[model samples]
Target: MINRRIMMTSLAAGLIAPAFRSAFAQEWKAKYPELIFAIIPEENASGTVERYTPFCAYLSREIGTKVTLRVVQDYAALIEGQKSEQIHVGWYGPASYARAYLTGAKITPFVIEVSSGGIKGYYSVFYVKKDSPYQSVADLKGKNLGLVDPNSTSGNNVPRFVLDKMGIDPDKYFNKVVYTGSHENAVLAVQQGTVDVAANWWNSDDDSNLTRMAKKGMVNKDDFRIIYKSDIIVNSPIAYLDSLPEDLKAKIKQAFLEAATKDKDAYAKLSDGKDDPFQPVDHSAYEPVVNLVKFIDGLRKKNG
Candidate 1:
């Protein structure tokens, strides 16, 4: 009965494997009873908390550990928290994630957003009030420029890269270059005449920071116009520390991948239903963005 014995062994292995995995998961769960998830301050702290708490709840349920949201003041704080390993998981813009990775954070990107259009990339745009005389970057020469945080992707890094490519050094080209601190603030600066033009993220005419702000009645979409749009940059990614166990990372990733279908309400709150779903991604997908951030760093160093 050699065949019968082999079948019995196979079935036993199959049964033991799942139990073994369950036990292993329990061990890690005990080790990490709670996880800290940090998000960059794309909006005000309250808004950030409101948007992510439900998602964090879903993650906690899926991972069998407490997932707490850590809202920081700015992108640098989030980067620093992750670098020190105080933050286990983080949602980051492309440049901020690259900055964290390049500056000694042992993090691995695991999921990226797929837009409702099914695109995995977004553009950095220059915005000006609709009635402003600035029709183009050339029209805004010697005017003020508003940027978001220094670590922002579309708000700072991509805009810097695009301006450099056009032989426009912001310091020399603008009368003043101001960091407005957030995309919403940057847009407000433009609208209120604090800055002549502001750099911010735009996915499409219908889906962007401007559109979201419009929905909140914070800014009228018709009050501004886009002056410049950069080449499509890789979408933002959510990453976790590499020190986390392999099985845990897998579970974290699977939870995100399943979030759209399994936790539709939370997912909708995240992007205002503008994005399709979270898709699997890896470090390789962001290598180009890393290089872009490095290039921007080089410019800063040279200019300094």
Candidate 2:
């Protein structure tokens, strides 16, 4: 009787083990047939969607699976999505990527954008109207200031980091501060004389804010003056959630690395026509930004 009982127990355990492994696979693997690719709203939502639609379609074809482009509310939303495994892929700003890493998000970046001039990074440029009397950041004392979102690399972190190093505290230096929400709006504020100075991103000879604005006849390059520029902060990154199946992540990364050169038209739209290629990058590229975030946090605490 004891021998028969042991044989029955062994048979039952074998039967249940396969079902348990199948259930575990279902939990660990992707739930949907289509991958959700999220874009943090560096600009307006409509523009972001329009720019990435082609890239997403190409990615879908390259990966043999459908990929959807989603424009998140802001940097915070993308971070949360990655944390929850809702965003399988992400395109994030330097500071945002650093923040995600600090906050324990599961995303890992694989590519960093390089501009047309082969510039590996961009600067946080502080600008004022050409006719403005402000000759330097020091001259902007007691004047209104416009800044993009706090999560912004070029728009906020770089400016703050640079200013702190120069011994200028923006909170006390400026009479009023305006969070313009986007680089376009921040630059517009300066052009319209709403603020004495504004911070925006810049890369020499690239189709950045003012140059693109010039092409649209919105703002002339001569109309604005760059008063201050931060050191070359690293370019933006494209990342994937670590929760993805290893094989799927490999396919997506391979697809993105080729998307730029293979489809110039689509890549141009994604790059604002700079034709920058997506180059492989690791988490180490953003170490400086991580320290910047910490530095900015210390300043904020000091001020408050």
Candidate 3:
């Protein structure tokens, strides 16, 4: 005689097996019905919207899942989403990625929007007013310098790292330092003479932020000069949560790399008309960023 409890338990298991099997065999679509990608609105607002719309559409078609793009107000929002595992994919700057990786977010399928000559990196330039006596990094000694933000790679990390290599400690070298919160703010601070120097990232092309400011009459091209430049650091990276299923991770990576080459319009939109193409990359490629963070930590200790 079968016990009543045993009979009920067996019946439930029998009913659930088919459902489990059906889900398992339903391909990646049924696994994650909704795929969400996050981007920083401040850093890449227009470009992000333009690129991700069609890209998500294509990805939805290929993976048979509902892909949605979400934009956050700032880098912190995107980083938080990645930490909570709420975001499946993200486009992160190098310093932001380093901070996330330190907190356990996984880096995968590193890709960069290229410019001329298939470049993966950009440089940090220190700009000062033309009439200012500051002509080079050395001139900033004992003068105020404006940094965009502590977590900013091109604005803060790169500038700090370059100064360290030159045997000049930013904290000790500058008479005062201010955090402007954004690269645009930093540029404005320098242009207004509120700060002695400002640091930012830009390609060799003349049509960058610097040029825009020059064009808008906010600042003249001849009015400001580059006082210092840092070594090229890799552009921001796209990262995923480590807990994602390995197969799903592989498919996402494959999709991005292939899209850059296979979809010309998708690639162009992502690159902002720059000659950038998505190329395969790995976590280890960001070693330089890690090293720069370590150098920054040392500076913090010294300053403290």
Candidate 4:
């Protein structure tokens, strides 16, 4: 069974009233007692569990259903799970969701993460230790570079696109390019000087992985410096399986919107306090990402 018990700190009290659950919430209780809400394993499974438990709980209470929080092993697990209807609602990365939607997964995006500044997107950033002499992406030539994961939008896809746009092939531009697996790890590698520079996401107007780590007391923002930033990339989106009953999907979307509006702080947590509240979106919002995926795919095919 997918785990429902996720460890997280308590959220603010009285933000969501139990009275707000729709009256029809009980109608499907017998048919679907528990709904599975899965996350793409952007970070370590343990960290995903810790951060998203409260998020899932808030949705559970708002929707008046038991929402089980599950973190799949990788992007493929999540996309396949949604395609198979094993996952109900998914907190998916933009590129992954686009791939899932294009491949005929019955998935529909309804809400996108907004940062504290009312921006619905973020930037892919390349950073180095504060003391490093590098001042630009060109300067990183013949030096180590770190990336998050292959499926990571801000970490890999967008960064690759940005580099190519700058006439740099990551494959040959850097002395060494390493997939560090997670944003936190990429940031950590830069802080620890394991890599000369690493790519990660930052709030377009606010904080980023480094700030998030600082918020956790893991590292200070002053320890690293961002030398290059890609254009705004849409933040990850929350998508629900289209196979779900229409009413259930509506309720799920409404529940999440309400929770995000009332508990904006918790909402901010999703995007490192760069977004405020949440906003509705559709598959079209991610078309650029789909195209980027295609471009990246073309690059890979050419390389082979």
- Of the candidates shown, which would achieve the greatest lDDT relative to the real structure? 1
Show where candidate 1 strays beyond 4 Å: 1-16
**Which lDDT tens digits does candidate 3 get at residues 148-238?**
7777888888888888889988878989889886766788889887899988878775745576556546566777788777878887778
**TM-score, predicted candidate 4 vs. hidden true structure:** 0.85
Cα lDDT of model 4 overall? 0.80
- Candidate 2 C-alpha RMSD relative to the actual structure: 6.3
Q: How do all the candidates rank in terms of lDDT, highest first?
A: 1, 2, 4, 3
lDDT of 4 by residue, 33-87 (tens): 9999988654567766777777777878877789999877767788899899888
Better model by TM-score: candidate 1 vs candidate 2: 1
Tell me how candidate 3 scores on lDDT: 0.75
lDDT of each: 0.91, 0.83, 0.75, 0.80
What is residue 114's positional error in candidate 4, in angstroms?
1.1
Output the lDDT of residue 96, model 3.
Answer: 77
Which candidate, 1 or 3, has the higher lDDT? 1
Worst 10 residues of 2 by lDDT: 23-32
Q: How far in Å is the alpha carbon of 70 misplaced in model 1?
A: 1.1
Give a tens-digit lDDT track for model 2, residues 152-269.
8988888888888888888888998898987888888988889989998888744677786676576788988888877788899989988787767777888888987777778888
Better of 3 and 4 by lDDT: 4
